[model samples]
Target chain A: MTAKISIRGVTKDFSVRDHDEPFTALHDIHLDVRTGEFLTLVGPSGCGKSTLLDLLAGLTAPTHGEILLDGVPIEGPGLDRGIVFQQYALFPWRTALANVEFGLEAKDTKKRERRERARHFLDLVGLSGFAERYPHELSGGMRQRVAIARSLAFDPDVLLMDEPFAALDAQTRETLQEELLRIWEKTQKTVVFITHGIDEAVYLGQRVAVMTSRPGRIKHVLDVEFEAREGDLRADARFGDYRHVVWTLLRDEVAAARQEAPVG
Target chain B: MHLLKGLRRVAAITLLAVVWEVLPRTGVVDRTFLPPLSEVLTALANLAATGELLDHTQASLGRSLAGFGLAIALAIPLGLLIGWYRPLADFLNPLLELFRNTATLALLPVFVLLLGLGETSKIAIILYAAAWPILLNTIAGVRGVDPLLIKSARSLGLPAHRLFQKVILPASVPTIFTGIRLAGAYSMLVLVAAEMVGAKAGLGYLINYAQFNFRVHDMYAGIITISVLGLLFNVLLASLERRFSTWRATS
Candidate 1:
C-alpha cells in the first residue's frame, strides 16, 4: 500500500551562535508513513523526533531532501494536515467553542455549520458544556481537549502530534491517551505521534520507530499488535513484552543523548 | 449605605465654605489674595449669567478635544504598525525617542512661533502631549503579545490580515486602552499650559486674565472650572476604557 506521507532522505542542520559547528539535528532520515497508520517516533532528548515531525508539518523545509503528502511535495502549513503542539497553544482570546471553530472558519465554512461541527468535536472530547469557557478559564486537560477538537474539526487527512500529552499529569495523560485512541479509531486519521516514553509509544502506537542519539536516524521499528486494546490493556503480559522491547531499544540511545546534552 | 459618605463629603465642603466666609471677617489673612469662597461662587455665577464662562469652557473643551481626537486617530494606527512591523519600528525608534523625551509644554514657544498665537498652537501642544503615552502604550501592548498565539493562528492557516484582526488586535486592545486613558489627563495638562502661554479665551486664559487684573475670586473660579473639566475628562475615558477593554481573569 502507498504511504500517506513519504519522508525522503531528510537532513536538518541548524547554525548555532558564533563560529561553532552547525548542529545536525537529523541526518539522512527515511520513513514511510502508511495510509491510516498510527506511527510513533520514540527517542530521548535531542533525537530530532520533534524536528522530523516539524518537517512533516511543513513548519520548516528540510535542509536536504523533501517530504511528500499523498504523492505531492509538502510546501507549508495547510488544512490537509493538522498539528497539536505540546504546549497546548490554544488562543486565550477565543472561547472553547470558537477555538475549535477556528480552523473551520479558516476553511471558510458557514457560521451555522462551523458551530455545529465545533459542538460535535467538543462533545467528542467531553467538553460539550465548556463551549463558552475561554482557554484561561479551562483546566490544563480541558485546554488540550479543546486543542484536539480544534485540530480534528477541520478533517485533516493526517494528524501530526508532537508530545501533545507530555505536559499533563500521569492520570490525565492516561485518560487522554484512551480518549485519543477512541478518537483515532473513530476518525481513522493517519497519526504520526512523537514521544520519549517507551510505555506510551508501545501502548498507543501500531508501530514504534526507535531513533538514535543526536543527528538522529531511525534505529529500529517494532510492529505492535494488541487487538482492540481497551483502556486497561496494559495489565496483559504481551503489552509488558512490547514495553520491555521498546525500552531495550531506547535505553542506550537515551543514555548517549543524556551524556551529549544536559536537559533543562 | 453610601449616602453617609456623600453626606460627609458635603459637610466637609460646607465647613470649608464657612471658614472662607468667616476667615476674611476675622482678619486672620489678607482678603485680597484669599478672597471669600462666596465671592468666588458669586463671580462664577456672574460669569455664567453673562455666558462668558460658557464661551471660555467651550473654547477650552474644543481645543482639548480636537487635540485629543487627532492624537487618538494618529497614534493608535502608527503604534500598531510600528509595534507589529519590525522594519518600521527600527526606522522610527530613534526619532520617536527624541521627540518623546522633549517636554511637550516647553515647545509651546516653538509652536506659537510657527503656528502663531491662535488655537493651532494650543491644539498642537495638546496633541504633542497626548501622542506619547498612547503610542508608547500601544507599542508595548502589541509587542508583548504572546508569540505562541501568532504561531497558533498561522498554523491554523489564518492569513496575515485575519491574524491581525482575530489575534493581534484583540490581544493588544487592553494595553491600547491604557494608553488612551492616560492621554485624557495629558490632553488637559498640555491644553491648559498652551492656553496660558497665549490665548484670549479658555479656562487657562481666564485664570491668567483674572490674576493680572486682581480679580482673585474670578481666578479661583477659573481654577475650579479647569479642575472640574479635567475630572470630567478622566471619568469619560475611564468609562470608555472599562467598556472597550476585554481583560479577563484567565490570563
Candidate 2:
C-alpha cells in the first residue's frame, strides 16, 4: 500500500541558551503512514510525540531528513494536511459557525456555501445547535468538537491531531473517542493521532507505534484487533489485553522520559 | 438591589449640585470667582441663545474628531505593519521610541511655528498626542494574537494577507478599541491646549475670552460645556467597543 505520508531519517533538535550542543527531540526517525488508516503514536511524556505531530503539521521543520506527502516533499504548512491542536485553539472572536467555516474561508468559498459546509461539519461533530456560540461560551468537549469540525470542513487528505482530548474528563474522552471512530468510519480520512494514554492508543489505533524516551524512536508497532462499534471498547477483554501490551512496552520509556532533563 | 445602587448615584449627583449652588451663594467662596450653579446655568442659556456656545462647541468638536480620525487612519496600518514585519519594526523601533518618549504637547510651539497659528497647528498637536496611544496599543494588539491561531491558519494554507484580515485584525479589535478610546480622550485634552495657544473659536478660546472680560459665569459655562462634550465622546466610543466586542471578555 502506498503511504500517504513518508517520514525518513528525521531528527529534530532544540537549541538551548548557553549550551553548546542542541537538544535532540527525535533521533533518526523512520515511519510510513499508509493511506486511509488510523495510526496512533503512543509514548511517554517528553517522548516527543507532540513534537512529531508538530512536524507533520509543518509548524516546525526537522533539522535533518524530510517528510513526504503523495511523493511530494512537505516543505511547510499546506491545506492538504489538517491539524487539531491540544489547546482547542479556536479563535475567541469567532462564533462556532465562523470557526468551522475558517478553512472554507481560506479556500475563498462563497459565503452561502461556506455556511452550508460549516453547518454540515458541525452536524457531523454533533454540535448543530451551537452554531452561534463563541468558544468561551462552549464547554471543553464542545470546543474540541468545533476544533475537529474545523479540521474536517477543509477536506484535507490527512488529519494530524496532537492529543486533542487530553484536557477532557473521562466521560467526555470516551464519548469523543467513539465519535472520532464513527467520523473515521464515515469519512475514511487518513489520520495520524498522537497520545500518551495506553487504552486510548490501544482502542483508537488500527496500529499503535510505541516510542522510546527522549530522542524518541519507535520501539514497537503493534497491530490492534476489534471493530470500532457503538459500545464501550474498554469493556472488551481484547482491548484490555492490548492496553496491557502497550503499557508494558511504554512503562520504562515513561520513567526514562520523566528523568530526561525534565523537559525544560 | 440594582435600583438602590442607581438611586445612590443619582442622590450623590444631586447632593453635589446642591452644594455647588449653596456653597458659593453662602460666600464660602466668591460668587463671581465660583459662581452659583444657577448663574452659570443662566450664563449657559444666554451663551446658547446668542449661539456663542454652539459655535465654540462645534469648532472644538470638529478639531478633535478630525485630529483623532487622522491619527487612527495613520496609526492602525503602520502599527500592524510594524507588528507583523519584525525587520521593519527593528528599523523603526529606535526612532519611534525616541519620538514616543518626547512630550507631545512640547512640540506644539514647533508645530505652531511651522504650520502657523491656524487649525493646522491645532489639528497637528491633537494628532501627535493622539497617535502614540493608538500606535502603541495596536502594536501590542497585533503582537498579542494567540500564536496557535496563526499556526492553525497557516496550516490551512491561509496566505499572509488573509491571515491578517481573518485572524490578526479581529483579534486586535479589543485592544485597538482601547487605543481608539485613549486617542479620543487625548484628542480633547490636547485640542483644548492647542486652542488656548491661538484660535478664534472653540471652548478653549471662549474660556480665555471670558477670563479676560471678567465674565466668570461665562468661563464656567465653557468649562461645563467642554466637560459634557468630553463625556459624550467617551460614551460614544464605549458603546462602539461594547458593540464590536460581544464575543470576548473586554475587561
Candidate 3:
C-alpha cells in the first residue's frame, strides 16, 4: 500500500536561552503512514510523539530531513489535514453547527451549502440536537464530539489527533474511542493518533509506533492483529501478550529517561 | 413571587422618600439647605415640562456615546495586534504605559488649547479618559487567550486571519466587553468634568449655570439627572455584557 504521509529522517530542535545548547525533540525519525490506516504514536511524556504529529501536520519545520504528503513535500498547514486537540478547541462564541462550518467557510463554500455540510457532520457525531448550543454550554464529552465533528467536516485526507481524548474521564474516553473507530470506518481517512495510553493504542490503531523518551526516536512499530471489536479484547490472551511486549520496550526507555535527568 | 419582589422594592423606595420629605418639613434639617422630596420632584417635573432637562440629558448622552464608540474602535484592533505579534507589542508597550500613566484629566488644558473651549474639547477629554480602560482591557483579553486554542486552530489548517476570526476574537470577546463597560462609566465621569470647564449645554453646564443663578432647585435637579443618567448607562452596558457573555462562564 502507498504511504499517505512519509517522514524521512525528520529531526526537530528547540533553542533554549541565548548561547545555550539547543534541545533535540526528535532524532532521526523515519516513518510511513499507510493510506486509510489508523496509526497511533505511543510513548511516555516528552517522547516527541506530539512533535512528530506537528511535523506531519506542517505546523512546525523540522531542523533536518523532510515530511511529504502523498508525493508533495509538506510546506505549511493546508486543507488536506485536519487536527483535533486534547482541549476540544471549539470557538466559544459559535454554536456547534457554526463551529463545524468554520472549515467550509475558509474554503468559501456557499452559506446554505456550508450549513448543510456542517449539520450532516454534527448529526454523524450524535450532536444533531445540539447544533444551536455554544461550546461552553456543552459538557466535556459533548464538546469533544463537537471538536471531532468540526474536524471531520473538512473531509480531509488525513486526521491528526494529539491525545484528543486524554483530558476526558475514562468512561467518556472509551466511548469516544468507540465513536472514533465507527467514524474512521465510515470515513475511511488515514489517521495519525498520538497517545500515552497503551490500551487505547491497542484498541484503536492498526499499527502502534512506540518511541523512546528524551530526544525521542521510534523503538518499535507493532501491527495489532487482535479482534476488531471493542468487547473482551482486554481479557484476550493475545491482547495481554501485545501489551506486555510494548510495555517491556517502554520500561527501559522510561528508566533511561529518568537516569538522564539532572539532579538539583 | 416576582410581583412580591417588585412590591418590596417599591415599598423600600417609598419609605426613603417619605423620610426625606418628612425630615425637611418637620425642620429636622434647614429647608433651604435641604429641599423636601416634594420640592425636588416639582422642580424635576417643571424642568421636564419645559424640555430643558431632556436637552441637557441628550447632550451628555451624545458626547459620552461618541467618545466611547471612538475609543472601542481604536483600542480593539491595536490591542489584538499587540497581543498577537511580539515585536509590535514590545514597541507599543512602553508608549502605552506612558500614556496610561499620564493623568488623562491633566490633558484637559491641552485639549482646550487644541480644540478650543467647545464641545470638541469636552468630547476629546472624554475620549482620552475612556480610551485607557478599553485599550488596556483589550490588551489583557487578547494576551489572556489560551495558547492551546491557538495551537489547535493552526494545526487544523486555519490560516492567520481565519484563526483570529474563528478562535482569537471569540475567545477574547468577554474580556474586551468588560473593558468596554468600564470605559462606558469613565466616559460619563470624564465628560461631566470636561463640560463643567466649558460651554452652555449638558447636565454639568446646567449645574454650573444653576449655581450662578442661585436656582437651587434646578441645581438639585441637575445633580439628580446626572446620577440617573450615569446609572442608566451603567445598567445598559452591564445588561449588554450579560447578554454577550452567556457563552462564557468565567466572565
Candidate 4:
C-alpha cells in the first residue's frame, strides 16, 4: 500500500537568545504513515512530538527535509489536514454547530449544506442535543467531542491530533479514545495521534512509534495486535505485553529527558 | 425568588429617596442648598411643563451621541489595524502613549482656544476623552485573542481576511465592549464638563445657570435628570454588549 504521508530527513531547529548555535528540536527523522492507518507517536516530555504534529499540520515548516502528502511536498496549512489540539480550542463565541461549520464556511459550502453536514457530524459525536451550546457551557468531554466533530466535519483526508485527550480525566480519555477509533473506522482517514500515555499508544495505534528525547529521533516502531478490541482489551495479557514493550523503549529516553539541561 | 431579588434591589433606592425627602424637611440639614426630594420633583415637573427639560436633554443627547459615534467609528478600525500589524503598532506606540497620558480635561482650554467655545469644542472634548478607552481597549482586545484559536482557524485554510473576520474580530468583541461601555460613561462626563464651561442649551448649562440664578430647586432637578439619563445610557450599552456576546456566561 502506498504511504499517505512521507517524512524524510525532517529536522527542526529553534533559535534561542544568547545561544551560539540554534537548538535542534528534532534530529534527522524518517517515517511513513500508510493510508487509513492509525499511527501513534509516544515520547518523553519535550521530545518534539508536538513540533512534529505542527509540521504535519503545516502550521510550521521543517528546517531541513520535506513532508509529502500523496507525493506533494507539504508547504503550508491546507484544508486536507484537520487538527485536534489538547485544549478544546473551540471558538467561545460560536455554538457547537457553528464551530463545526467553521471549516465548511472556509470551503464556501452553501448555507443549507453546511448546516446539514455540521449536524451530521455533531450527531456522529453524540452531541446532537448540544448544537446550540457554547464552548463554555459544555463539560470538558463534550467540548472535546464538539472539537472532534469540528475537525472531521469538512471531510479532510488526514487527522493530526496533538495530545487531544491528554488534558481529559482518565475515564473521559478512554471514552474519547474509543469514540475516536469508531470514527476512524467509519471515515477510513489516515491518523497520526501524539500522546505520552504508553497504554494509549498501544491501544489506539496499529503501529506505535517510540522516540528518544533531547533532539528527538525515532528509536523503535512496534506493531500492535490483539484478538479483539470490542471490550476488556486493556485487561488482556497481550495488551499488557505491548504496553510493557513501549514502556521499556521509552524508559531510558524519559529519564534522560529529565536529566538533560533544557535546551534554550 | 426572582421577585424577592427584584424587591431587594429596589429597597436601597427607596430608602435613599426617603432620606432625601426627610433630611431637609425635618431641619436635620440646611434647606436652601439641599432641597427636599419632593421640592426637586416639583421643579422637574415645572421644567417639563415649560418644555425646557426636553430641549436641554435633546441638546446634551445629540452632542454626546455625535461625539461618541465619531470616536467609535474612528477608533475601532484603527485599533484593529494597530493591534494586528506589529510594524504600525511599533511606529505609533510612543505617540499613543504620549497622548494617552495627557489628561483630556487639562486640554479643555486648548480645545476652547482652537475651536472656540461653540458646540464644536464640547463635542471635540467628548470625542477626545471617549476615544482613548475604546481605542486602547480595542487594541488590547485584538492582541489578547487566544493564540490557539488563531492556529485552529489557520489550520482549516482560512485566508488572512477571513481569519480576521471569523476568529480575531469575534474573539476580541467582549474586551472591545468593555472599552465601549467605559467610553459611554466618559462621553457623558466630558460632555457635561464642557457644557458647564461653555454652551447655551445642554443640561450642564442648565444646571450651571440655575446655580448662578439661585434656582437651587432647578439646579437639583437638572442634576437628577442628568443622573437618571446617564444611568439609562449605561443600561442600554450593557444590554447591547450582552446582545453581541450572548455566548459569554452571565456571571
C-alpha local distance difference test of each model: 0.89, 0.91, 0.87, 0.93
lDDT of 4 by residue, B1-251 (tens): 99999999899999999999999999999999999999999999999999999999999999999999999999999999999998999999999999999989999999999999998998999999989999999999999999999999999878899999999999889889988999999999888788998789999999999999999999999999999999999999999988887776731
Each model's backbone clash number: 0, 0, 0, 0
Off by over 4 Å in 2: A227-230
Clashing pairs in 1: none
Docking quality level of the chain pair in candidate 3: medium
Report the number of the highest-DockQ candidate: 4
Q: What are the chain A TM-scores of the candidates, in order?
A: 0.96, 0.97, 0.96, 0.98
| Residues A1-264 of candidate 4: C-alpha lDDT, one tens digit per residue | 799999999999999889889989999989999999999999999999999998998989999999999999999999899999999889999999999999999999999999999999999999999999888889889999999999999999999999999899999999999999999999998999999999999999999999999798999999998887789789999999999999999999989998987653
Q: Give the better candidate number (1 or 4) by lDDT.
A: 4
The residue-by-residue lDDT of candidate 3 on B1-251, one tens digit each, is 99999999999989988998999999998878678988988999999999999999999889988898888888888788888888988998899989889988888899999999988888788888888888888888888888877886787667788888878888888888999899999998888788888778889888889888888888888888888888898999999998887878741
**Docking level for model 1:** medium
Interface RMSD computed for candidate 2 is what? 2.4
DockQ rank order:
4, 2, 3, 1
Residues forming the 10-long window of minimal summed lDDT in candidate 1 chain A: A255-264
After superposition, the stretches of candidate 4 with alpha carbons farther than 4 Å from their true spots are A261-264, B1-9, B26-28
What's the TM-score of each model vs. the native? 0.90, 0.96, 0.92, 0.96
Residues A1-264 of candidate 1: C-alpha lDDT, one tens digit per residue: 689999899999988878488888999988899999999989888788888977887778899998989999998888988889888878776789999998998899999999999999999999999999888888788999999999999999999899999999999999999999999999999999999888889888999999998889988889999866874689888999999998988899888986875521
Report the lDDT of model 1 for residue B137.
Answer: 93
**Candidate 3 RMSD to the real structure:** 2.7
For residues A115-158, write the lDDT of model 3, one tens digit per residue: 99999999999999999998888889999999999888978999
